[model samples]
Target: MEGISRTYPGRMHIAAMHPSTQEKSWMTALQHLKRKGAIMALAFLSTTTLVSAAEVTYERLLNPEPGNWLTNNRTYDGNRYSPLDEINRDTVKGLKVAFTVPLAPPSVGAGSFSSSLQGTPLVEDGIMYMSDGWGRVYRIDMTKGDRGFINWIMDPQTDPEFATGILNNRGVALYGNNIYSLSPDGAFIATDKETGEVKFRVETQQNPAEYFSMAPLAINGKIIIGPAGGDGPMRGRLEARDPETGDLIWTFYTVPGEGEAGHETWENNAWETGGSATWVTGSFNVARNELVWGIGQPYPAYSPKERPGDNLYSNSTVALDADTGKLKWHFQYTPNDSWDFDEVGSQQLYNAKVNGEDQLLLGHFGRNGFFYNLDGTNGAYVNGEQYVDRVTWTKGLDPKTGKPVEYTPNGGVQTYLPETRLDASVFTTEGADKSYCPFIEGGVNMFPTTYSPRTKLVYGLAIQGCAFNQAAIPEDEYLTGSVSAVDTATGKVAKRLDLTSAPKGGAFSTAGGLVFGTSANGDLYALDDETLERVWTFNVGTMIDAPPMTFQINGKQYIAVAVGPGGVGMNFEKYPARAKDENAKSMANFQQASTLYVFSL
Candidate 1:
């Protein structure tokens, strides 16, 4: 009985029962166990859970709303096309200035913000996110008032000293719940897009003298950013970091490092400070998982002797592994570049039929006077041709190599001159006027050309002029700068439209058979996509060096362009061809104009 008592249920004690009666207790215990099991089963069935992560689709990214501006070029195809035909060719002439953000000079010597509104606004739902020249973000409510009103303003201008005098933020990138932007001094700031509240800010690059001015480009939950120290002694590098935590995922230096594949191209440790930083925006192809971006040139503006070899990745369109930041392939447009013509134009990615196969294409109007269409899959040169008349560096590029042979050898480093600006104490070498056509200032300065998929033609505005001085550096100093285009199918120039004024503010081609671009003379013209003839024009009364962006709001087509003076184009505007001064100022009078002009029909 004592032994059996050890297993008895405490609450069901039967002190006076016989040993055989324990069977009855066991039966009661079994009943209790059954009740517990049933209760547990009922609890388990009551709870239902999902075990899959949420998915983000391209359809969610590219909304179907005609009022939305989805991708950077208005669409991933980079045509800068808006299908909102409510303001078609018939009604575009009646397009009137709907609203204007008036301007007042920021601080003196803050660099001319005068009309320097370079950002291409992004519209979603009913909100317009636009950046002014001074790194100021304004949220305009397209649905607020009957005509729309300012919802809120985010002014990131606390430190006026850190200003590069150019409020050149291209715009902001929206991912998940945050909006990312880069300050003039290189801080990547995140803000709540819905509310004008600052979430966080971190320095992407740190150099007081070397400024950083570009909008954050987000891809695959990472914010990819690079510095803009083209005039400094540092080589540029591209970086990918966590958009929320600011943790670095990977980095791809424009120039190779020690014992790396492209390290042999650099002279000494010049590749260490080589300038291929991408200051503009980049594009990604989700299906291929490749981020396509144009690398800037090695700096020093004029001298190439400091940095040598083909400068592997500089002035090249690089296809990088989005997951690992490893360089998959690169097509260098200008090697051993001395011209400030950075390959850093906005790289546009798309897919079309080529040779009867659906091939991915990446296009750009290289500052060095050419338009290219390369296989986005492996960086293969599919098509390339001259888009300018005054490209004296080479007759043309070898289709197989995608390089200009004669121009590839001598990278415009003017080593022939005596070491006049050498700092022996620091072992630093600096030379003057050692660059060829299209100096580091660019035949086209910081302007982008758009490729229209609808017309099957790439549209670009080019400068016809040539640089006066050239560095007779070496056959290895391949420095040539100019603007040009190419037919993707044949890699031939369909036509070359060269302007007396250099191309500023990139080009935009639309699906409505129109191409829009701004010039240094403060004139904005729309070209017929098929004929490349002027269709419409507007004078903003100041130079424009920003890419124009278009979208549809409320069934009305709207066009917007940022105008900023004190750019290289301002030099030609103030001092025309007949301006009498041998030692004329290359950079015209600095004036500050900070405003955004919106027109619609």
Candidate 2:
């Protein structure tokens, strides 16, 4: 009875039952095949004419309905904004937890690195499609607002010996009759959306250190996927595959090969293992026919001295021809970055009037501590500003070019504020604490940000503190959290909210005039879109790692977020505590579990 005995918060899990033998190696994958099989059997016995449900056609994805969250970002532009206003500010006060579905127990076996839920769930009609760390996709029937029924689950059955360690999958993609996702071990899987049967599985990992985590971006007939594990010695590349057969269509290597256009930017052959991981999903500029995606920093993180020159694609926003996977243009954010400034965050696409003319723009809250607004069509830098309070990386950005004032043109190794560089500290010989602004994880790294069309403000969960033992900061503001509301037009911060704990969990906005976010201390809260005031809050008593998403069913709107702290960095273990963060101390002791939560008003 131990397999399914892992009940919901109160009663026995309404899903299934299994013996203690199931939880040994990993959580027993107590398959609910019987229930799904019975449903199929009943369908055959019924004689009445039955109309097949709708399929996820390209046209529907191009124009998603307000009642359903069709994509991970809810739209191709990655605004993460929902137009449903049923649960406005006034009615939001009455919002309460509607249902909770516990996921498969995280594996802790021999090659496992503590699996967790870090991906956003997709909702269509009233069914929720999500996957666990082990690449087990679950089809949950959420037609009943009060509870959720696990209809079926498709386990990829990855090999335990060669199972990827970091089993975090960002999310899954939906196209036609299939649901797509990549296992941590690099198995690109296409599963039947209705029956939970895998249609095809393609091996994409070239080596053991080339796993995947990002959710595939499905556009029209192509599924876009990129390799991860870039922190190790592996070249990163993005591939376009046929959704039906999982065959490669084209490839775009993040690191330029020898004799390639940007290959000269890398010196000493550092481009081979250069890390420019595209581990997060990006935006698609439909009008421009460009797929705008953010890239990560180079390998040997925090030690740029090992790799000279300005890494071209790393720390950049590359606009690629969506149909051909050909790089059209690119804009590098951090040149020769030494602070682990991975720019794999949001590439939020929006339109705004610039100088009396409307222009398609790309807005991003850079991990290097700036809010940038670039031309979405050609990757041109329009404007940007520092969103975080303290930044010592450089004096400031150049007003005209948007590059750092200290940045040198055609320079191999850069020395931007010498004092802030990892001076002979840990990068050289032994170890020494070095001071730097915007702690190593960065202003925001891979966490989804929100762009509210109503307020014209891009909200980001920002860490407003520094690292190193010798840095000088006020007692109250040594290391803390912040919510930066940057104007989409000017790229300037309009309102900033400082919180007691780090707001690590991501956020999303709704036409209801609310911005829903989560804290590392296990808090889910809603803020007024304009004023940025906390209107509601609910603590699940466990840290949250994924962002909040919104959808509507039965003429009623719902708010959803995956909760659990199976990942690290929630507790400040690396940098010593300066001022006591609100939930830092206790959150370290909190139990880790995978559970999906839904809310309704």
lDDT of 2 by residue, 1-601 (tens): 1001111111112233442553432233322331221111110011212222489998988999888888879899988999999888999999999999988777642343666678889989888888777677777778778888777676655555445456667889989988898877667778777765566667677756666778888898899998777666777788888887888888888989997888888888999988787788888888878888988878766667788889879999999998898899998988988877888888999988776778888999999888899988888889889988789989889877889899998757899998788633333443344667886667877889999999989999987677554333345544567898988888889998887766766889998899998876678999999999999999988777788898877888888888756545433322213324654555566677789999998
Q: How does each model score on TM-score?
A: 0.78, 0.88
Q: List clashing residue pairs in candidate 2.
A: 1-19, 22-28, 309-412
- What digit string (tens of lDDT, one per residue) describes model 1 on residues 1-601? 0001011111222224443667667544654553122110000010112121122234645543566774455654445656555555555576666676554344322444322556677766656677655556666665431344554555544245555434456777766665667666566666666555666556554454445666666666788887776556666778887776666788888878987778777776777667677777777766777778877776554456666577778888888898899988888886765556687776777666788888778877667766777887888888766665556555567767676655435443332213221212111233333233433344454566677667666666665544442233332322222224446666566765544444567777666766778765556777666666666778776556677777665566777665655443443234222122232233244344555677776
lDDT of each: 0.59, 0.77
Candidate 2 residue runs with Cα over 4 Å from true position: 1-52, 109-112, 160-165, 423-431, 469-479, 570-583
What residue runs in model 1 are displaced by over 4 Å at the alpha carbon?
1-59, 62-64, 107-115, 144-148, 158-167, 352-358, 407-435, 438-445, 469-486, 496-500, 571-591
lDDT of 1 at 355: 81
RMSD to the native, candidate 2? 7.0
Q: Compare the candidates by TM-score and give the number of the best one.
A: 2
**How far does residue 248 in candidate 1 sit from its true spot (Å)?**
2.2
